[model samples]
Target chain A: MPLVNRVKELRARHHLTQGDLAAKVGVTRQTIISLEKGSYTPSLMLAMQIARVFEEPVEFIFTIEEETE
Target chain B: MKRVIIQSLSSIILYILMAFTIASFASTVTHSLAALKSGVFVLEFNFLPFLLLIIFFVVWTIYSFRTRPNQQMGFGQWSVRMTEFSEVDEREALITAKATKAAYVSFSISVPLFMLTFFFYPLFQTAWPTYPVFALVSTLIIANLVYMTTWIRAYTR
Candidate 1:
């Protein structure tokens, strides 16, 4: 199952730019971009950091999608 | 990103320059020794390559240290950083690890290829005395190029 994330949507809801979110989580903007593009799965620490920044639960921000194929 | 690219290119140039410097220095000393043994007593030497090598080494060292990630030396002290070895974040660290593996693979593939070229060394010994020197240098150059290419590709992709 692929890990799906609401990083982009949550970041927008929180009125934060990619750079702003990355700054809060101590990662590069590229990492944030990759995360939003669904090309990278954040580590547990990073996922927690993102959830903390967005004031959401880690489970709410990230979930495993059911495999369809 | 631009800085990283420039750093890779500069390192390639530095490796090539080092090869030329070593080859020239070795050739000069060998020829001088041969001439002296044969009672010719000639001291023909060229300092241009050596001087250029020194100048470029200094410049590259300064540029590398300035642009590369600084590793904390403890208690507010810092020193020179090795590229692809010290990174600022997890993604960068992962990329460096991949690049390092690429370099190792290239080195493994290149050494045997260079060694194979050694069989032909005897044929070109008189005509190209510096063939082995170049072959050795080329191995290092190829490994570095592969590492840089892998790193750049990972970053872009």
Candidate 2:
């Protein structure tokens, strides 16, 4: 199940790498890698903060796909 | 690697101490007069513990050298400098649960085998299975504990 996220795109829009996003989000680059790799799902608070980082809604930044059910 | 080194050194020291204690006890357990009756008692001290200790040291040395520590943070690619950890997230916890479940399953499986060895095989040897059985069961338990702690540390950090 894909935990679809605008993380990469949003970060790209803001000219940020995974490391930059990770520093802003208070986590490790590997965490960003895990998030991007769909190996781990971020906490709601982290998701919300990630959305805030990109100046987007939580839904806009991260959306659950069908298989997540 | 540091943790593994520390654990190896400590377990080595402990095994040496145990070996020494076991050997010393054989001579000291009986009176000096009783020792004389069992002619050559003091002189015929068994070198079993010394032999076992040497074997353990060699095997452990090889095993320790072969076993790599699993610290992933040393790669220097991480973004955050995590200094504290108080809890784990659900996902990591689930992974920990999986490992712990494996240990529990392994432990449960050990019980029957333990009974077989303790009772059924008391007077006989069964392919030298006891040591391997003990090693495997204990290693599983220890690995599960490591997994659970690492999982907890992962997110709480």
Which RMSD values do the candidates have, in order? Answer: 2.6, 9.3
Cα deviation in Å at residue B24, candidate 1?
Answer: 0.6
- TM-score of each candidate structure, all chains considered together: 0.90, 0.51
Alpha carbon lDDT of each predicted model: 0.79, 0.57
Reference interface contacts recovered per candidate: 0.25, 0.08
C-alpha DockQ for predicted model 2: 0.28
| Model 2 CAPRI rating | acceptable
Tens-digit lDDT track of model 2 for B1-157: 2332354344545445454645455445444457779775554455666676677767655554443233353434322321111113334434445545654665666655656656645455434333433444444445444544554454344
User: Which residue pairs collide, candidate 1?
Assistant: none
**iRMSD, model 1, in Å:** 1.0
Error of 1 at B6 (Å): 2.1
Off by over 4 Å in 2: A67-69, B1-94, B125-157
Candidate 2, clashing residue pairs? Answer: A29-B79
Tens-digit per-residue lDDT, A1-69, candidate 2: 567776777777899999898888777675777787666788898898888888888987777887445
Chain B TM-score for all candidates, comma-separated: 0.87, 0.34
